[model samples]
Target: MSTQPPSAPVAEPPPAGWEEARSRVYAVGLAAALPSTPRPLAEADGHTLAEPLTTRTDLPAFPTSSVDGWAVRGEQPWRVVGRVLAGSTPAPLTSDGTTVEIATGAMVPEGTTAIVRIEHSARDPEGLVTGVPRPRPEWRLPGEEARAGEELVASGTPVDPALIGLAASCGQDTLQVRRPPRAALLVFGDELLTSGPPADGRVRDSLGPSVPSWLRRYGCQVRAADVVGPVADTLPAHVAALRSALGTADLVCTTGGTMHGPVDHLHPALEALGADHVVNTVAVRPGFPMLLARVTSDDGRVRFVAGLPGNPQSAVVALVSLVAPLLAGLQGRQLPVLPQVTLAEPVPGRGDYTHLALVRLDRATGTAYPVRHVGSAMLRGLAGADGFAVIPPGTSGSVGDRVRVVPLPLLPGERTW
Candidate 1:
C-alpha cells in the first residue's frame, strides 16, 4: 500500500523593501483613520488637529504694550494722564503731550505715537514724562501675529503644549482633533516568564511591559488592562486572543510567532480569521520577519495587526520602522520624517538587506556612534541608544557620511533640539 506524505508548507512571498513596507502599512492606516471630535484644550494634547486652527479675532485684538512703558501721543515729555493694566481698557490719548502708564501686555491707548520704556523714562515733579523712543515700535499692533480668521496651524498637525497655548491665544476654547487610536498588545510565546530572570531556557518578557509605553509615545491609548501576554503557543489560543483584542482595539500588536516554525501559530491563526496581508516581511536586518495585516471584524470594522520579532532589540526596530508611521497615518498626521546625522564611525552594511544600527547621538556635534551590545536579543544597547542609523541596502556607512536616523520618541518632560 502506497502512503502519501504530508503536503509541503506553502512558501511566503519575497520580503518587501524596508521603505516599501513602511509606506504600505501607512497607506492602510490612513485609509482607516479614526473620526474627528471636539476636545477641550486640556484634553487635546497628543491628538491630531482635524481642521486648520483659525484665529477667531486678530492676534492681540488691540494694540498691546510690549513692556511696562508710557504710551505717549504726539511727542515725548508728555503729561501722564492715566494708567492701563492687563485686562483693562484705558481712555484714548486724545490730547497731544498726553501719556498713559501701560503695563506689559496691556492694550495701548488709541492715537498713541510711541511707547517709552519705564526704565528709560524720567518723571518730573509735575508728573510729566521724558524719554527717547527706540527705533523699533515698543508695542505690538493688532493682527501683528495673525489676522482675524487666518489659519495659524494646518490640519493633521499633532497637538502639543505649544500648540495648545497657541490655540488658546487664538480664542479657541476647544479644538477639533482626531481621537487617539486605541491599541492592544498580545505577546505570544510559551517560554516567556512574566516576573523573573531567564531560567531553564525561558526568558523574561520585556515587550509586554515596555511596548505599552512606546505606544503611548505615539499617541496610542494603550491601557494596562489592554496588554495580554504569554499566550499558549497553540493555533486556538492565538486565534482567541487576537479576536478578543481586535474586538475593541483599532490596532493589535503581537510579539513573536511570526515565522513558520513548528510552534509558531500566528500565520495560521491570521489565515483562519481571513486577514489580508499588507506586509509579510521587510528587508531590514535584525527585524526582517516583521509583518502587518488588515483584519475586518464581524461588525464590519477594520483593524490592524502588527507582528513584531521575538528578539528584544529587533522588536524595537520593527516598532520604529512600521508602527510609528502607521500610528501617524491613523491619526491623520503627516508621514514621519527621518532626521540626518553624520556618522562618527564606519558601519558595515548587510549586502542586500537594509542595516539599522543602534547608535548614540552626540547632539553637540550632530554625530552618530555605534553602541555596544546591540545584538538582536539584547536590550542593553537599546537602552543607551538615541536612535538607529539607517544604512541603505548595498551601501556601507562611512565615517562622516550623512545618513538618515530614526529617532526614538522622547519620554515625558524630555526635550530635543
Candidate 2:
C-alpha cells in the first residue's frame, strides 16, 4: 500500500466577500475554542460561560413577604404574637386572631392566612391590629422568580455585573467559563515613531498602544509586554517576531505588511511558518488587504495570525471586521449581531466592495450621520465616531435608509454620544 504525505499549503484564493471572510474566521476560531475552566464570580466578569447558569436552589428559597405588613391568621383585628425581620424565621400562627409584624423580604411564617400593609392597618390601645387585606397575596411564594435547577443564563453568554448578581442569588460562587485567549501585537514598520509627534518622515505608531485596548474590550488577555513595535522591516525579523509571539499567544496581530509592497514581508513570513490562509483578503473598502492565517506547532498546538493594514483607520476596520468575530468564537460566543440605524444623510457605496463609512450615531434620534476626516489612513474621524455604517456592495445608502452599524466596543463605564 502507498502512503501519501500531508498536502502542502496552497495560495489563498481571490478576495473573499466581506461577510464571508468574517464567517470563515469565526468558524475557524470556534473549532479551536479554548478549554473551559472554573472561575470565581468576582473574576469571571468579561468572560464567556462554558455551561448554562442554573439555579442551585429555588429563587427566594422560602415564602417571603413582599411588603412591610402584618402577617395575620384567620382574620383582621388580630392580637400581635411575634415579629419577623429580614433573614429571620418566625413561628407558625398557632391560633386564630393572631398576627406577626413582618418586614419586606422576611420569610412568611407557616399557617399565615394573609398580609395587611402597615399603612392599611390600625392598632388601638387594646394592642390589636385591624386592616382589610387586598385580594391579591402580598407575599412571594418559593420559586417565584425561578425553580431549583432552572437555567437562568444560557451557555456562551458574556458575564456582566448583573449576571454576577444573578449567579450569586442562585447560590453560585464560581462559574464555568472559557478562558480568555491570550494575544500579542506586532507592529511592523521601520518608519514609525514610538513617542512624541511624527517627525523626519516617520509617523507615530498608533496601533501599538491602541490595538491592545481594543483587544481587551473584545475579551482577549493582552499584556503590555506582549505589544512589540517597529520590528525591523526584514523577512527574518518578521519570522522571528511571529515565532516568539506564537510561542505564548493563541493569536498574534501584526500591523502593516499585509499588502505586497516593497518592504512587505508578512506573507513570506507566514509561508515560512507553514501557515494556512483562513482569509487572504476581504471585499471591503479602506481595509481590503486584511488577512487571517492559521499556524500549527510541532506539538500540535494551533495559533492564529491576523494581518491588519498599516493605515490607522484601516487597521481599526480590520479589527472590527476580522479580530472581533474571531475572539468571540474563541470564547465560545455566538457571532455578534449588528444593530440597525437610520441614515441621516446619503452615503456612497464602493462598487463591488462593502463600504464601512465612519459615522457618529445620534442615539436620541436613532440616526447615523457621516463624520469628517474618514480617509483610509486618517484617525481623526475614527476617534470621533461611534461606529461604522455599512453600505452593502452595489447599493448606495440614501437619506432615511436603514443600515447596519458596526459598533465600537466601549470600555467599561465609557460612553460615546
lDDT against the true structure, per candidate, is 0.92, 0.93
- In Å, residue 191's CA in model 1 sits off its true spot by 0.9
TM-score list, all predictions:
0.94, 0.93
The per-residue C-alpha lDDT of model 2 at residue 389 equals 94
User: Could you say which candidate leads in TM-score?
Assistant: 1
Worst 10 residues of 1 by lDDT: 408-417
Which runs of model 1 end up more than 4 angstroms from their true locations?
A: 1-9, 412-417
Per-residue alpha-carbon lDDT of candidate 2 for residues 261-335, written as tens digits (9 for 90 to 100):
999999999999999999998999989999999998888888999999999899999999999999888989999
Query: Roughly what TM-score does model 2 have, to 2 decimal places?
Result: 0.93
Question: What are the per-residue Cα lDDT tens digits for candidate 1 across 1-417?
Answer: 759988999787999999898898888888988889999999999889999999999998998999998999987679988899999988888999999899999988888989999899999998889998898999988898999999999999989899999999999999999998999999999999999678999889999999999999888999888999889999999999999999889999999998999989998999998999999989999899999989986777889999999998989999998999998889998887888999999999999999999999999999999999999999999999998999999999999999999899876346563
